[model samples]
Target: MTTLTQLEWRTMADDHRYLIRDMALGDTTISETVLHPDQSTKGHAHPWPEVYLCNAGEGTLYLDHDGGHPLVAGARYVIPGGVHHRVSTVKGVTFTCVFEGPRR
Candidate 1:
């Protein structure tokens, strides 16, 4: 979908301020997540490498407990799996993450 409203967004898990929707085809999965203001995705990791596109807003992407980079709109990032990572937003952020295999 080209717009946020065009996608079937839904509350993700029990994480407050987090919303997500999934689109899967074949062996790939793409998930769109919106993080509200003053919230974070919490430090977590997956078993497979993935990529993320900063769809909107601004945020910081920290990996492996080290310094992070600014996540500006229109930016893309590739994060290897098994590495600790987290996203913290200021005025909220919307990002689309792509990974191989089905959504777990």
Candidate 2:
């Protein structure tokens, strides 16, 4: 098993738009991500289900025409496969995401 502390895996993005840390195995992936204010994921979809936990800050999770949810600290969200979605950071956002897929 692998484990990481928040500070242990804190890694900055190329553009410094966010910080991403991975704790994944096989096809299932888990990650912790932090975004600065106004940061977004560029709206995309994966083939697997995604689970998210908002750890801090406020933001909106946008899904095409379905609008968004005002993500508060400690909130949780789940997204099914093939649903185009992206996150918009308000005053900066931090979340952990889990992706379910085949075992490695």
Candidate 3:
């Protein structure tokens, strides 16, 4: 079995305070993000829907129409396809996004 430390991380192009990594699970892609304190995503959208699951820490999820929502460990949020969203961390957050096909 592969450990968490064994996963490969890549620099996120959207921001400097975040790191990302992707793993293929069957036909789906799981993208994990590591966000440092006071950091946030660049806000974007894709053609495929996604599920955001937080593993640790806490943050706020800003949606295109729904405004902002609290994000915490063990919580999950569904993001519809073509809808824009971004995440900001007060401390730090480690989360995984599950989506179909490949990363866009």
Candidate 4:
């Protein structure tokens, strides 16, 4: 893998959603992803475990195994490997995410 000279990058989509950069090397990745109300990642599972910190906003975090629940500010969610999960933003959401495990 090549080294990243810049630690972070930022961009905004045409739809006005913010695209926070993810920076990492080797088997770990970290990023702050902001999603608007009703936004969501299509349900899926990754090879690694992922931790999500809800820094702001409200929503419903859904894990296929853990069931759906209200996501309040300051809450943190952890998902183990092989667990199907996805998050839906109610009134929008911002999360600091960390991922660790064997790289896919």
Candidate 5:
């Protein structure tokens, strides 16, 4: 039981692409990522599965083979391990990403 507001957020990626707050809970790691307008993350793959919950704004989620998907506030997406994915936003977005793996 942890309060998100109590955690410290750190900047990540080139040009402050995103702000993240990470918390480790037993075997799982939960991260909050905030992306401002016109920001994007480079496509990459992870070794463990990841789940994303959109908390605000609209965006685009790029998945390998699946192309891009609409990412609106209140949406959720589950990505399999080793699947390449990236996120881009046009109007700023905040996402809660959960995974049962080590934090990068």
Candidate 6:
């Protein structure tokens, strides 16, 4: 068992612009991501579906070609496998992303 307090947060890279804490359980991976204002993630796709649970602040979830969906605290969004998607924040945001497969 693991707790948030036990997880160590780390930045991916200078260009990524976000902090993350990842935990692996069996075949699933749970990651906590924190994005500051004006920060965004690069659009990408996964081999399996991804689930995001908003924990704080506000943001937008951008889908391929389509526009974007508002992201608010306490809301959840699911992105299907192979679908391009990304996230951006205006007032900063923290969310938990759960992957259906092993941690990559």
- Of 4 and 5, which scores higher on TM-score? 5
lDDT of 2 by residue, 1-104 (tens): 55444323434354557777765465666777888887786678877778889999988988754878877788898888888888888589888888876322
Instruction: Show how many residue pairs clash in every candidate, following the order shown.
Output: 0, 0, 0, 0, 0, 0
Better of 2 and 5 by TM-score: 5
lDDT of 5 by residue, 62-101 (tens): 9884768888889999999999999999889888889996
Error of 2 at 104 (Å): 13
Candidate 5 weakest lDDT stretch, 10 residues = 6-15
Clashes of 6: 0
Better of 1 and 2 by lDDT: 1
Q: Once all C-alphas are superposed, what RMSD does model 6 give against the true structure?
A: 2.4
Local lDDT at 15 for model 3: 62
Each model's lDDT: 0.83, 0.75, 0.84, 0.71, 0.82, 0.81
**Candidate 1: tens digits of C-alpha lDDT, residues 1-104:** 35545545344454677888777655777888888999998678888998989999999999998889888899898999898888999899999988998766
Q: How do the predictions measure up, each by TM-score?
A: 0.83, 0.78, 0.82, 0.73, 0.83, 0.83
> Candidate 3, residue 11: CA error in Å?
6.6
Among these predictions, the greatest lDDT belongs to: 3
Candidate 2's displacement at residue 100, Å, is 2.4
**Candidate 6 regions with alpha-carbon error over 4 angstroms:** 1-16
Kindly report which residue stretches of model 2 are placed more than 4 angstroms away from their true locations once superposed.
1-14, 25-27, 101-104
- Candidate 4: list runs displaced more than 4 Å: 1-6, 10-20, 101-104
Q: Which ten residues in a row have the lowest lDDT in candidate 6?
A: 7-16
Instruction: Give the Å shift of residue 92 in candidate 1.
Output: 0.4
